[model samples]
Target: MTDITASPAGYDIHNPSITEADNLLGQYIPIHYHFQMLEDQARMTGFKAALNYLLADGGKVLDMGAGTGVLSFLAAQKATKVYSVERQADLVECANALLTENGCGDKVELVQGDARQYLPPEPVDVVVCEMLHSALLREKQLEVIESFKQRYREKFGGTLPIFIPNASILAVEPVSADFCFQGYHAPIAFFEDPGSLSTRYLSMGETKPYAILEYQADNAIELSFDGLLSINENGCFNALRFITKNILAMNLEQGSTIDWMNMNLILPIKHPIDAKAGDQFQVRFKYDAGGEISSLINAIEVIKA
Candidate 1:
């Protein structure tokens, strides 16, 4: 919980209680977000590759919740027109300055407002949003994109905008990390969990596709994993590592991996389970729809594969 009275950083971007008016004034703004985004080469390169293919013919683009206008600038290189929407005043100002510095101020239009309600002057052929987090948590990627997609359909009457990440899926794997609870740099008490420091440990197992979210799909999202994992080696499983596999663009048949596609969410299991090679276990993974930071894990039974 955050103290509402004190104005520390300015605004809580994640907290929904803050009104739109306050958000425009730069309350609780994350000062280092844009810096971090700029530093992420994998993230930037992935979008660049996607935009290079999508905007080859000089189409129009709408960058919802555009932070620092990086994606907008990338699209503006080839697109006929680009609209960058951002609600935070500080970010909007910073992005505007960056656009000018990059010599793209004339090409891209910066819009300062909530993207959900904001509409472009003309229909856009493509929409780009990079609000994704590990396991789709702490960000409104789905909600914002879904709203834009819905509003675009209603306004354009069946015309659809191309989503940057056409689809994304979540994967998980059981692992045995004995020293995961302790600090790798040094031993620290703050990093210790109640039952995480176990002496017994085992190697990790094969990963599985646990949950999936098709951003362009109209169907309700299903985020649950109930399946059996084959135990290749005898080891103690104590944690589940979640991975986000995103399809940044379609028709790219390259075998090379995207650097930004590697963000793993590691959650400790309630209890460590000992297992042997050739043994199969009924593993189940689920999390609160509202909060995906932590998840509930279950291993019903271990049987011979």
Candidate 2:
């Protein structure tokens, strides 16, 4: 697997402050980091497939948070026109060069501005935004999209554009995590790369779906969830593993769906709780989308049952 932390500006997963800063100032993130995202084959393949499938009929498209303008380039292949909006001036310049090199300057228009404030002159057939993060936290995906949706509705009436990755499923599982590395111990929240062998899932309870976020529909800024998870094994429930599955695009005719890769988040509990087989745990958590993980940590309540 490629090293996600190879860039000079890359963040340490266990360092909350650094990670939070990166999330808040995502537009200013270094260009090398964007290159890493472009190099992700699974991410590129899934998004490319979805774009090809959706743009088959050829319609106007809006690419929000259009990093590197790659999605805009893809949409231009079939869409009549594409408005690619990116806040970072550097990325916009780079994307402009790439567009010229690819001869897509005629079909795609690159705009430098905040996605939340940008609105196309006319209604679009499709809206593509990929500002996703684990558990819908630490990223402005929900905030930016929600703002755009409201503005678009006010301007274009009830007709809404089709959103790519229309929905996301959020699930959690109780696990025992060993935060010890070479005799040093640090119980900090971290992201586990998919297919990584370092982190093991020592399950204490059955994984449960906490939320299903539909991007097209109105969603709450702050989310609160409380549920009981049945324990099926004996172990120390030291952490909660969060998984986000993005439904990029679905083809009903062929019963197929395209999805992008997201790292699994392992958040350590403030106080680890011991559990046994046939036990139950009442887990309650409240957080605002695009908020710091520390907020979630402060609001978490775990009760033994």
The numbered model that scores best in lDDT is 2
Candidate 2 residues 123-223, lDDT tens each? 99889998887888776888888899999999999888889987888888888888888998888888887556244556677889888888899987787
Scored against the true structure, residue 225 in model 1 reaches a CA lDDT of 73
RMSD of each: 7.2, 5.1
lDDT per residue for candidate 1 within 1-305, as digits (tens), equals 22223343343457554466634322334646666778777788888988887665689998987877889999998888998888876677677877888888898999888876887888988888777777665456776777777888788877787878777777766666554445453211112121243333333677789766666777343357778877777777666666777778777686543324536655566666787777676776555322436333333223334
Candidate 2 stretches greater than 4 Å from native:
1-28, 195-198
Identify the runs in model 1 with alpha carbons over 4 angstroms from their true place.
1-29, 180-203, 219-222, 252-262, 288-292, 295-305
Each prediction's number of clashing residue pairs:
4, 0
Name the lDDT of candidate 2: 0.80
Candidate lDDT values, in order: 0.67, 0.80
TM for candidate 2 is 0.88
Model 2 pairs whose backbones collide: none
Q: Once model 2 is optimally superposed onto the true structure by TM-score, how far is the C-alpha of residue 140 displaced, in angstroms?
A: 1.2
